[model samples]
Target: MSSSSEEDLLFAVALLANEEEEKRERKVWVHNIYEKRETYGEFHHLFPDLLKDRSKFFHYFRMSQEKFYELLNLVKPCVERENTTFRRAVPCEERLAVCLRFLATGNSFRTLAFSYRLGETSVRRIVYDVCDAVWTKLVPIFMPQPDKEIWERNELEFRERWNFPNCVGAMDGKHVVFDKPANSGSLFYNYKKSFSIVLLALVDANYKFVMVDVGALGKNSDGGIFSNSIFGRKLQQNKLDFPPDKILPGTNELMPHVIVADEAFPLQRNLMRPYPGDESKRNTEKRIYNYRHSRARNTCEDSFGILSKKFRIYQRKMQVSPEHMTKFVLATCVLHNFLREDHPNLLAELIEEATPALQDLRGTGGTYTGSALRIRDRFKDYFSSHAGSVEWQERMINVGRRNTNE
Candidate 1:
């Protein structure tokens, strides 16, 4: 982030370099070539060597060779533009590669320009343009569209994989910090004591983001931000194609399909949060219910973790406009899903351990409907009974009690 921000001060200089730098200074290499180009040059030449050295490939590019090619092919059409009589355009492959490197490292345009043999101004333009293009072309194909069939499939998978029934997706919000924007005082300032925007994401059981809402200010509660988003409005108005209310696996009582979240979101017929207070600790059933709910909701947290640890940009504060940062969120999410589909081994390392930190469980949300409360109760009852209880959930809860000496 510091490297990138320092380069930001030189943006105007980059814009002026072609006219001033060479004019004032005698002779320097016109083409900014660096050592990375020797190895990073061409896929036809480099990819084979990269495949033979998978560890080096993952270290340098942070993706498999095939996955890189897939993304190159995906974004090429959108970012590629033909050159006319003016001159030959920069190759589509180079443009895509530069953007990927920037996203992968959050490196300065200065570093990218020299490393990729392009001018600084050109590198800056290419990277962000490809970012916008990636979001535009690939998002619809990769990010889950909130339709009934999709929702139902996601819910079924959550049940099959996590033993948590009636769950459509695991939803959560992550506050992405950024440097302050010009003339904006504290509108974007968050309780984290940073200027930021939040990315509200919903990932399915398999780690694909089924739904993502970006560009919310950092100051608002997750519930408030969610309630104000377009998806939230559609959700509240029943415009999204949520599955019809259905009976539990063994029970006669019908329950509406819902998204599971931490307590920072509202509990509704269509959204579920965990049981609250000392009762959840003292009561075995409620304790088991909280464990189930948290385990299911942890999918979203795991997805966020995978993204942060992989992308490494969200690991630091982004230095761009909130709107620009939204594009980053969108593109990374789409690419995250695309990579999840294309390369199962990409996130294999941390797949087993994706539990969120205890800090995530700290907040509370709004009062929901009586029906919502009853629906939660119904789930609680079902999970405690033989009809929905996991084979070892009671044992796990008991073990946890022993660990805490409760």
Candidate 2:
């Protein structure tokens, strides 16, 4: 972040040196030579010493150092020690801005180092160390276990809006494209014929990301990824802490709390997925279940889109190694969770406007046409046929109630 910010400042300064600085000075200046060509040059003459001093440039440069510093302080941690080598080596504000720029734009470390006035190795170390410190310090604070109160509030909202109960979060998976690593041709390639990684996430009713699992091979389907994930395993074994198996707040019947997922996941007694079968009756029932299930599950899409669009790192082709890419991804997600919690209104505005029109056109259910009604009827028939099976009927009843409420 520090390096990246410096790069921006350098660009801004370079622009000023060319336009404003050259107009006053009579001599031309070349900032640096690379590949036998002068990279940073001014049209008119300005002494190298004058441009070397940043204060002189800042005297007339349009960039806001204070705003950059203010943003950096919010992201910086107070160093515990007064004399650590890392602390003494870099300025807090500069490093924070560099990291922010890294996330804000997926620029290379070399480019960042030049702009930040730091060694290439230093830039790499700062980014890694700061990212590590942040992940360790902030992930728990921002992404803690969902408390009973939070779950209850979500349940009420789901019941009121989607006819679902005890739905703590909506879970889903999507593929994020990545550059293929050397000699690993088709292994990382997905069904889409693109090199990618799968992102599994769970989000709350408010569309805030609650949990994320990345680094899964893209060949793994959503169900396969979820089934093998730690969260999925915990859910399967009932290892996650849960409330008493009793009715929840403002409801008469026992509230059924679970994560909502798509048909790609397996339907367990505890995990709710759409009914399976190719029969027309079953298909219709599945469609109706999907309609309701999507209402909640779509939050994952919103979360991913917002993170990718806001950070901009995900927008570009990440040039780091696979391991660093994973770290970058996790770090980005954790940071997003923090910003969403700490600066929600700003995040909301960014998300609302970030998605381009073409991207928004892809994910929409045809219209509120008669197809939904047909599925509703099929749902009724399925419930009637499975009347003798108490468990199936109960699940169906929950779906029925959710549909009506929604």
Assess each prediction's global lDDT (C-alpha) against the native.
0.77, 0.58
Q: Tens digit of lDDT per residue, candidate 1, span 240-313?
A: 88888888898787888888988788888888889886779778788888889988998988888777766756
Clashes per prediction?
Answer: 0, 12
The C-alpha TM-scores of every prediction are 0.84, 0.63
User: What shift in Å separates residue 323 of candidate 2 from its native position after superposition?
Assistant: 1.8
Q: Largest TM-score belongs to which candidate?
A: 1
Model 2: ten consecutive residues of lowest lDDT: 357-366
Please, what are the lDDT tens digits per residue for candidate 2 over residues 1-406? Answer: 6999999999998998788766655333323442122233221123244346544322222113443344345456642224453224455645655566676667788887666555577668777766666666667776676667766776667656555555677776766666787777676677767666766777777666677877777666555677789878887787766555445344344434667765566554345554433543445444555555666677766777777766666766666666667777777777776555544454455556455210111121111224434433433343334321123434653576678889
Model 2 Cα shift for residue 356 (angstroms): 7.9
Off by over 4 Å in 2: 1-88, 147-150, 160-163, 183-186, 246-255, 275-288, 341-349, 352-406
